[model samples]
Target chain A: MSDAKFHLYYWPGLPGRGEFVRLVLEEAGADWVDVGLLPESQGGGARAMMEALGQGAVPAYAPPVLKVGDLEIAQAPNICSYLGERFGLVPPDEAARLHARQFQLTVADVVAEAHDTHHPIAVMKTYEEQKEPAKAHAEVFRTQRIPKYLGYFERVLKANTRGGGRYLIGSDFSYPELGLFQIVEGLLYAFPNAMRRIASQVPGVMALRERIAERPRIAAYKSSKRAQPFNPKGIFRHYAELDEPNAMK
Target chain B: MSDAKFHLYYWPGLPGRGEFVRLVLEEAGADWVDVGLLPESQGGGARAMMEALGQGAVPAYAPPVLKVGDLEIAQAPNICSYLGERFGLVPPDEAARLHARQFQLTVADVVAEAHDTHHPIAVMKTYEEQKEPAKAHAEVFRTQRIPKYLGYFERVLKANTRGGGRYLIGSDFSYPELGLFQIVEGLLYAFPNAMRRIASQVPGVMALRERIAERPRIAAYKSSKRAQPFNPKGIFRHYAELDEPNAMK
Candidate 1:
């Protein structure tokens, strides 16, 4: 693999979307730097992220952008796919690669929906202002969306005739499994009640999440300081009111 | 291109995410069939889509799935990217292809947010059930999300020194431009008031939309019976109450 150092620019807080990117890097054992986590004197932090965003001739729509030499890539799935290709984290076959990307995109969809549970109306507005709607949004998320998405991944795992259904795409532990790991971890953090209730329904997915965590590198990364702990400020916030099961009932 | 005929299976009525796939097929002049629109006797319609979904070893999570030979691909952008690789609708260079996928994924983000405005609380519940929340959600979408996403596209266009800002990725129109075309069309249909107000700020994006419409094949397809009209039942729905500007204010 190329020894080119990769620079990841994301908000210096909770894992958020960057965790997906970080998982891929850490799993692949790639040499990368989290710019936001570094000291300002070292040309990092929120200011560094903002500077990279503005400095790029093509400004990133948002952070969690990956900078590789002169080219800066945005979007979490896109970055993962790029790293997957370079580090052989995806399947060798084209169709399998496409499927891997498709699953990753689906994972992105679930992540966005999960984030919206807390900020249902306006992300710019305080959660306090949107509390009522967030309650409603989180209800559906915990009930319908969680099952639909996790169930889909469950089906994906069961249907894969490769690797005894341990992988999401091909017969291997691709970049997307790392993504699945993040999604499962985020859900557990955000909605422990719902996730606990829903976990049994998606044994394959839960197993895969455990499998990813058990990987030597992943296990090391999780215990390391680099693996940021989940907080309320991130996408999957643990708002007690929003995490209630069957709130409408 | 290969003499393979593509079968696209989506919900029969709504453009929804399928339109992104449809636009690519239309613009590329690919021989494809809309499985949901065909006669049931001929192995088509919603039943056909359901059968296809069930038939896949790994069942599709949702619709707008493309069937080429034996492989059934789901997710709009994934289908487009696959076709793009074969039809030369994407840049020949690897980095550019990755970037096009990036832009397409961002478009997916915008589309998802736009959809969430109308179904902020519950997808399974009726729009009326979530009407109050939808109004609040749409207000933020109109005032903030529309500009933020469109502005991002505008920045992408401006940064592309290759085509003088005519295309999103490369000097030539790519698959993402087709996706962009569909997004602009959907926004204009669903949020005419907000779009009219926001259009001036993202002239680059608007112009690109117009440019895509002006494409010979796309123009022909627009007038063709196959070009489905926008409806309230789709992702970009126009509920009168939901379209009110700054409703919270």
Candidate 2:
């Protein structure tokens, strides 16, 4: 079953956006190839990823594309939803599936905001060139966006009629939950000071994060060498000046 | 046919994110009610929109939620996809549908970036409060992001074996094309200065915009009073200082 594993094309050396996809793949115990991990000569690494992205007829707007058999697609939520359907990780009900996608998309929103805090101008520009604006962006992300988004999820968790708030959608541990886990992990890494304040209010979300971490496979994956560390180069970077909550005023 | 229309929940006065949903509904010729347009007593206006959003069991994280019978979903792209399926505006093939979704999500990404140019620090804060950072954010958006995204879409259009670049997906029209139209419209409104510069290089995207605008249904919708004018309060706002492409150092 694992013989013809799915191929994941992403930039190497940082989890970045690809971490969301990696979480779902690792948790499902699915056989997949992280193209970045393969040898450069074997059509791997950043150059291979960029070449594949550039050549696609449909043209994905960015990386972290999943190629399964003949169908290749980008966008983390779209990929997760597809994988969820394939692996029985989504809600069985029709409406529930859409709700799961909403949650996944919202997670993507938060991730993008987090990324923008360090690169308020553009990703193409160096953070050093944009630190002043980054300072302002980080403050708002820390104070407003984080709580608004995370708190909404907390409410959703509390309101869940199924899974008793442990899962995002129904009673099942769905892929969106893995997304939430990653959001929590990244926020903790990027905005520890702000997340510390938010942590007390979003106990449900924190608990969900802890539970996902303890899952046997997830625990093993996180401890394994394949799991990448949160680095400054990635979406969730921790600049001491930007991470401080009171700097905006 | 227009009697029992789908209900749209969004803030009044500005098209905002709701415009994306509105374009699809209008082009599909689906009868729909803009709840924000109704009187406060009859469950219209901003209060009504907020209350309806609060009451949903599924809990939409933001507005532009669509209520079709008992199924209410938020997230503009999600709503558009749902409407796309209902109105026969989506690609019939599974892979193509996912590809359409990828395009829709990328459009969402560009919209978010555009919005951040005005509200770089926080949406909770006023434009005045964040004006300094916004000027900086907007500069990079003008010089880099606007071209990168529009250029990418131009390539997607050129690569399209379907619709001969007239439609985003296959030979027929899809919801994502409507989304692309809205993006172009909003960009033209918000950053007329920058858009004028990039317009020359993205002829395919520009041509697609013209074709969608000329469609009989869409043309009628634009002339009708139901079509709201672009205002400063929406996702795409025109701040003179922020719109100048050459302002950043």
Candidate 3:
């Protein structure tokens, strides 16, 4: 691994999308500094991060990227992959590694949908302006997409011959599972009734969430002041209209 | 290396998201099958590929994934990395490889926006329904996002001295650049006036796209009818409403 603490640039509050990376680092016992959280509140925070992210050959290619000296990386799942590879958290076998990545991407899809729950029209449009479409979009997501993705994950869990573990790959906690928990927790935060009713059907995923939450690092993170609650400002916004029962069903 | 011929599954009509993987395989002269284009009038062609694509985890993570036997890898840039590592397209040095990936992820971001041109709201919504919102989103992307991404890539080209030619990696076209060109071409197709104006300011990106477009393999592919036209069905739909020159300028 590269020397010095890996620097992470993300909005400090709300745990936000950046929390997925932070959670994993906590779990991995990685030495990483949350750049935006470094008391740069006077001015240079996400603005600096965004500006840095905007630089170079791949502009949309910034933030959520990790760096060690000259090596800069971006993309949420891609960052997870690099870290997972570094931590030995990823499987040694190629097939297993591929499976882990697949799980991560599926989670990202749901997370993106979760983001749409608040900003359904254009991200440029105020969330209040798009609130109606956001609610409608969230209904479809909760009713159709949630079950579809959860069911798929459940199937993968059942199919895992590695046999008997809450984590995706095995009994041990995998970062893939960590991301899944975050996704589910956020969905629940956004659509509590919908998640409760639907997730009750996906026992495998439900259990996976509980198990991941109970991890030592995660438990500490949650118990500690460091972890933030899901909010309207983040991807999984808790809008009462979007969370209405039978909204999607 | 692997016993099976690589199978790529994507929307057959346009060289949209999946084209990146196709370019890599073609450049390497790797034996591969494009499952989507194999006789749509009949059944089982695109369907089978689609089914297979949803198989396993990695590529199963998302489309434009490449399958090699038991391994189905996904995530556009990740797939590029895997193929690059295997095909010797990525740099052998670690720092360079990571940097190239960083650059490629930036390209992937632009490509995503290019897709957003057609369906800015949600993928499930029809173009007609989303046209109003899409206009604003497309306008922002064309004016703000395109130049930012292209300018960054130009910086990367300037930085990669050992990377040789105008190619993102220098000397030869890495698979990612081909995809990058497709993104630029798609943007140009959708927003000619915007691209024409923006491209004039970013000579490196403009020249790079032209150089990449004229490569022997790309030229051959373009002339051979394998290359498809950019259309409304794909990411960058050419709507006269979104391409306003004076407003953008």
Candidate 4:
């Protein structure tokens, strides 16, 4: 990459969508700062991040905004794609890069769906208030959406003769691989019962997940304090009621 | 810009996300085919589209897949970005292009939210089946989400001294401008009461909507047979109950 330092602004205390961008930054070994995690006295934390987001010449719609010098870009998948292109985390060819982005966007779709399982009626409302719809939404998500998405990825992996099933595009690990790894991890944590039931059917996806976790930089990052654990407040929350696998069979 | 004809695969009707890609193609004046609109004898319709989706080396997770020769790319925002880059429909500068994409992705977020307002509990289930939760979902969507998203876009427009409040980035109209137009049109159709109530608050967005519609190619495309009208089956559905302005006041 260039000598430019990357500054990432995300909500403090949760991985959420920000983790997708963080994965790329971690894997690329780029010089970066999680601005939201820094001390408030040093112009950090949520307030500083919000100020940066709102005050930029090109204002971002939400957090997980990436600032490389003066340019600010938002949307987690877009930021990851930008970082991937800059850090050589994406393939060299245009077609591969486009496909990688397409895959990453699909991962984003799954992440959004996972978030909706808890907040089915309204984002601002609590899960308890929407538990009825949440249950119904989680049912479809677990039995249908999860399998469909994971199955599609498994097929993509199996079809990637170029990567020999190790990556989403070409012969090397790219941002989409990292995205898949993160989504699989998030899904497992949120829906352990359903995920376990569906695991055998998507061996390729599981294998890729393990391979990504074993990567040296990723391993280090996972163990480091930078890698925040999934929580009930985040997108991928584990509600015992939502995690039932009775419908999977 | 090249002689290569683009083939777009989306569900056969109601505009939906495909219209976002269609707007780019129409504006670019690129030679393209809406494969889903063709007759069965000509290898058209949903079945053929599904076959192409499944058979492609780089399989798309969903439709609105753009095929240029052998390269297949999916995701509406991603496809729009690809077409924008190819047809010079995006800004020339890297930062401008990135910001355009960031804006387009935000538009996509709004579209997804609009879709959920009707089918809150599940996608596979009918709106009738999820009517209770859909009411709650639509309330928040109409009251909070609509204002929040449109307000954000309005701020972006006003901040663009470079575009002079005309375009999202730099000096010329880009894919995101078209996206903003499509979204405003969709939201107005989907939530007329709420949209009408909120219109005066976002004058810039409404004005941009008018300007985009007046553009020669876009104007022609809207009047053409290819431009499908909004219907209940599409993402932006008009449910009379859901579009109530009571919540707005």
Say which candidate scores most in lDDT: 4
Scored on chain A only, each candidate's TM-score is 0.95, 0.95, 0.90, 0.96
Question: Which residue runs of candidate 3 sit more than 4 Å off their true CA positions?
Answer: A1-4, A41-60, A164-167, A170-172, A246-249, B1-4, B40-44, B54-62, B159-173, B245-249
lDDT by residue (tens digit), candidate 1, B1-249 = 124489998988889899899988988889988888888888778888877775786578888899888788888888888887789988788777878888888888888988888888888888888888888888888888889888988988888888798878767888889888889998998988788788899999999998899999999988988888999889998876766554234
- TM-scores for all predictions: 0.95, 0.95, 0.87, 0.97
Query: What is candidate 4's CAPRI-style docking category based on DockQ?
Result: high
Quote the positional error of residue A158 for candidate 4 in Å.
Answer: 1.4
What candidate 4 gets wrong by more than 4 Å, as runs, is A1-4, A245-249, B1-4, B245-249
CAPRI band of model 3?
acceptable
Give the runs in model 1 whose Cα sits over 4 Å from its true position. Answer: A1-4, A245-249, B1-4, B244-249
Candidate 2 residue pairs in clash (backbone atoms < 3 Å) = none
Could you give the CAPRI-style class of model 1?
Answer: medium
Ranking by TM-score: 4, 1, 2, 3
Give interface RMSD, per candidate: 1.3, 1.3, 3.8, 0.7
TM-score of chain B of each: 0.95, 0.94, 0.88, 0.96
User: In candidate 3, which residue pairs clash?
Assistant: A56-B152, A57-B152, A57-B153, A58-B106, A102-B57, B59-B73, B59-B74, B163-B170, B165-B171
Assess each model's interface with DockQ, reporting 2 decimals per model: 0.73, 0.69, 0.34, 0.85
| Lowest lDDT 10-residue stretch of candidate 3 chain A | A54-63
**What overall lDDT, based on C-alpha atoms, would model 3 receive against the true structure?**
0.71
- RMSD per candidate (Å) reads 3.2, 3.1, 3.8, 2.6
lDDT of 3 by residue, B1-249 (tens): 224388776777887777777777777778877777667553226576577654553225347767777667666666776777688876687755665666666666677666666665567778888777677667778777788777767766666565553767655556667667777888888888887788877787788788877888777877777767778787667888888765454
